[model samples]
Target: MSTLHLQQLPLPDAEVYFIPHFIPAPESDVYFGRLVQEVNWQQESIKLFGRQLPMPRLTAWYGDKSYTYSGLENKPQPWLPVLQELREKVEQASGQKYNSVLLNLYRTGQDSMGWHADDELELGQQPSIASLSFGGERRFAFKHRTRKDLKPAPLILSHGSLLLMQGPTQHHWLHHVPKTARAVQPRINLTFRYVRG
Candidate 1:
């Protein structure tokens, strides 16, 4: 078995664990491949202080209903069949029902996400975030807020996998997708969340 295959073997969950080609072989490519073409990706600009700065990456959101977004107002896209199937699978595993998912498409190695917790009001207190990844691999880093010197570890999220961040992860730690020099392919991430009405 390959190293990646070995890593996929059930293990105790780390702060992060590599799912390693977690998607079933038959349907993996089709689901995400279609998603790549279907999502209406947009580069959004955020007002920082007095200046409007374009975010480093492109993003989109999908769900059962309309959602209020910061900087951009979005209307819900009708749920696709593949997404509905995936949602059911994720719900079975995580035991959480997510009404919406926020997608981030990293177009190049230069695109990245900044450090922040997912502690938004819509998520409710201590909400569980079930993040599904596909396409090129990227390094996801997490660091404890109070331990400056602690070595932040990297988790290479592979195609067709899920990572669950639960409990106080949002309250105590910050996570980010750092820029890389590696020649990376496009990646799509679906962070399934339950937004409170």
Candidate 2:
């Protein structure tokens, strides 16, 4: 049985919720671990300033529409059985039909996601993002883009847990996966989105 709740966290004028430990697939975790290994992940490069910096984290995108994306442009891989199954679970929980998902694999403690908001033109206005974490527990941080006075808060993302970013969350805040010094394990995060393209 999966236990989930919508708890509002302390934030500014905006609203945000923390859905701790939502994904209830302990057995499926192992299945996804093997799947992540078998899949062919390409190491892509990103342009920072005038120079190119190769992203440490591996990424893949899967969706219904054929649209170009910014940052690390990854070719959408055919959805595997496990991925498809996960998609259904997320869709039901969010009560929203998502046509696309961006998968990120953090191979080691060195791998990290930089500070960025998911506010994109393709995502339409006020987009809602559902992120599911599996494999390893890591610190996920969020900070207000304009409110520098607000301290950056950390949320421990565990295996089989889901974090949903909705309302004006992406518009007012920016989130990222920070690198840890402790012995870290591999983690796979799936951010489901509804792209109107």
Candidate 3:
């Protein structure tokens, strides 16, 4: 395995690292296929404005502890073999030990995530999150939490790419994957994080 080179993002009050091609093409293809078949994906509903609406994408949670966010409590599923393997690699690359992972599947161009920070109380302060992407390329954007003058920075998260968000990133910024009008294939994202005991 080649050493992953990290590129630091130029942003105030944030510590973010971008590593493109964290996994090789052949391995990434295999991992994507296996995970698609093995993961028990579900469409979850979110409560918005007194209405329950299904999320735009499929999701699964795996870890040793439960997590709660946005009025949803996610019970951890036992780690799958393939997920454990990938987690080990991610830990080695990010130098962070994570006990849980959240997987999101974007099936097409319309599937998206709204701007939000991963600053849940269960994640503790200054959490480190390692996000790995596979299958299709999508735009990942970040905007300052309070500064309206700062322009949102957009990044193309390609297949086999890895992005690490740490330090004060979550406290100062919010990120999201926006929907696009262009045709797109399925994309899978795995975000590894630690849950405070």
TM-score of every candidate: 0.84, 0.89, 0.98
Instruction: Specify the highest-lDDT model's number.
Output: 3
Rank by lDDT (best first)? 3, 2, 1
- Using TM-score as the measure, the top candidate is 3
Task: Give lDDT tens digits, candidate 3, residues 139-165.
Answer: 999999999989999999999999999
- Global lDDT of model 3: 0.94
RMSD of each: 4.5, 2.4, 1.4
lDDT of each: 0.75, 0.78, 0.94
lDDT tens digits by residue: candidate 2, 63-180? 7755455555545667767778878887777776788888888999989998988888788877878888888788998899888789998899888887878778888888989888
Q: What's model 2's TM-score?
A: 0.89
Give the per-residue lDDT digits (tens) of candidate 1, residues 1-197.
11233233122222333455657745767877888888788888887788999988888877975556555665777677767888887787676789988889898999999887777776877878888888888898776777666666567787887787776677767789999998998888888888777
**Candidate 1 wrong stretches, greater than 4 Å:** 1-18, 65-74
TM-score of 3: 0.98
Please state the error at residue 168 of candidate 3 in Å. 0.4
Model 3 CA deviation exceeding 4 Å by range: 1-3
